[model samples]
Every structure is written in C-alpha cells, then in structure tokens.
Target: MLDRAGYDRYLAAFNARDYDGVADFYVDPPHMEFFGIVITSRQELKDFYAWLHDNVEENVRVLNFAASETCTAIDAIVRITAKKDLTRAALDAKGATGFFPITAGVVQEIRQFIFYTTRGGRIEKVECALPPMALETV
Candidate 1:
C-alpha cells in the first residue's frame, strides 16, 4: 500500500515552493541534485528550490500517483494557472538558474523522488527528479 496522504503533503509543500517546509521534511539533508548540480546544505538547497519555483511559470496538480521503495512518483499534468506580469522585474530582482514553459494537458511527467523515512518517524531527506516533459508520441 502507498502512503498517499503523506506523499500528498510532501508534494504540496514542494509544489508551493515552501523551501523551509521542504527542508524540514528531511532528516539529515539527503543528497539532492538537478542534472548533476548537487545540493548539500539545507539553506543552499532551499535557496536553489526557491529560485526554481520563482522562475517557473506554472504549478503542479497530482493526477496519477504512486510510491515505491521510499520514493513517491507522480504522473501529473501541469497547468500554467498564472503568470506574474512583473516577471521581468521579479527575474531582474532575483534571477533564476532556469525556467520552464507552461504546458497544457496531462503530459506524462513522472516525479521520480525519494524521501528519508521510517516507521513513526519524520523524513530525514527529500529529493526529487523531474525529468523533461514526456508525452506519448502515439
């Protein structure tokens, strides 16, 4: 059985770009990275994640979800629910490592993610890999 509730909460914080909440989800700062860019410190990781959320033009909504081996993967469709008109100023003010295009429909995006967890215990680390959007070609 999958711990859907717990997974949902974790993803909620992640989707909201609550870097502090995300950090607290981890126990000892489990390794996290994006295309090989490693994140170690909680503050550094939070800053990195915050930058990502600020840059991105969309948010996620869980469509199909699953969990295995302490990892919770979700296949969800992202909607560009909103776009900041002041994006230019925001970017100029803070900047970002990278940003993504707001897509339509339920594209198959599997959130390959892992969390440090134990029975009746809090997670020690949380990491996720959001691979490039992949939709069925056929």
Candidate 2:
C-alpha cells in the first residue's frame, strides 16, 4: 500500500519532470489511462510523457489525496503551458487533443479526479474522471 508520503514523492517526481523517477512508482507493466488513451507498458508510459513534455510543461497540484490498501484517489488540478503550437490536426494525428485548446506560450489548467489501483506498493492501473457539473462550482 502506498501512503500519503509515498504518493507525495511520486507527485514530486512527476512535477519535477523526472520521467524515470516517476516510472519507479509503477509496476513493471503499468496500465494508465488518461484522456481516453491507454498505456499498457512502461515504455509506452515513458514515451507518452516524453512526447507530451516535448511540447508542453505539465504539472499537477493535488487538492485532496486519500489512500487505502489497494486504491488511491486524488482531486487535482493539471496545469499545462504550451511550448509550441499544437493545432487540432496535429493533436488528432497523435490520436488525442489538449485537455483544452492549447496555443504556443499559453497556459491552461483543469481539475481532474484520478484514481489509482496499487499492488505491492506500486501503481498498476490509473483512471481519471472529470468533475460532474454539480460539483464543478464547489
């Protein structure tokens, strides 16, 4: 089970743009889903982040975090600053789009509800949800 501190370290590594360090918190074959894209291998996870970081700087700020024996949940804000222009065509070619419209030199942020399933203190799967309209104002 990953405790608060362990999760904090993972967030630290991620916000620091330390891809390798962030990968250390996951199981060998990580299963991560974000914005409808599924990554089922460590190399894919690395590659995804690498490609994303190449175009923008991303950071997550946790508003709330909770962990139990097998699962962890978080309410977070994802901030992205685009380093280069990413047109819809380009994003579509990559099979995805920015969380919001992104223009070079622009900053965008959004709230996300994320869940993680862990095994042996390592993350095995992750999924994210958007806040419902009812809770968006809160």
Scored by TM-score, the top model is: 2
Per-residue CA lDDT of model 1 for 1-138, tens digit only, reads 236787677667877777787676665554654434467678877886665545344456676666654555565655443223334344445432233233323222334333343323345444445555532311
- Rate residue 31 of model 2 by lDDT: 94
Native-vs-model 1 lDDT? 0.51
**lDDT top scorer:** 2
Q: What is the lDDT of residue 16 in candidate 1?
A: 73
Cα lDDT, all candidates: 0.51, 0.82
Please list all clashing residue pairs in model 2, or write none if there are none: none
Model 1 spans with C-alpha error above 4 angstroms: 78-138
Q: Which stretches of candidate 2 lie over 4 Å from their true place?
A: 132-138
Q: Write candidate 2's Cα lDDT for 1-138 as tens digits.
A: 888899999999988878899899999889987765678887888888888889998888899999999998999987788899878777767766534547888877778888999998999999988875412211
Clashes of each: 4, 0
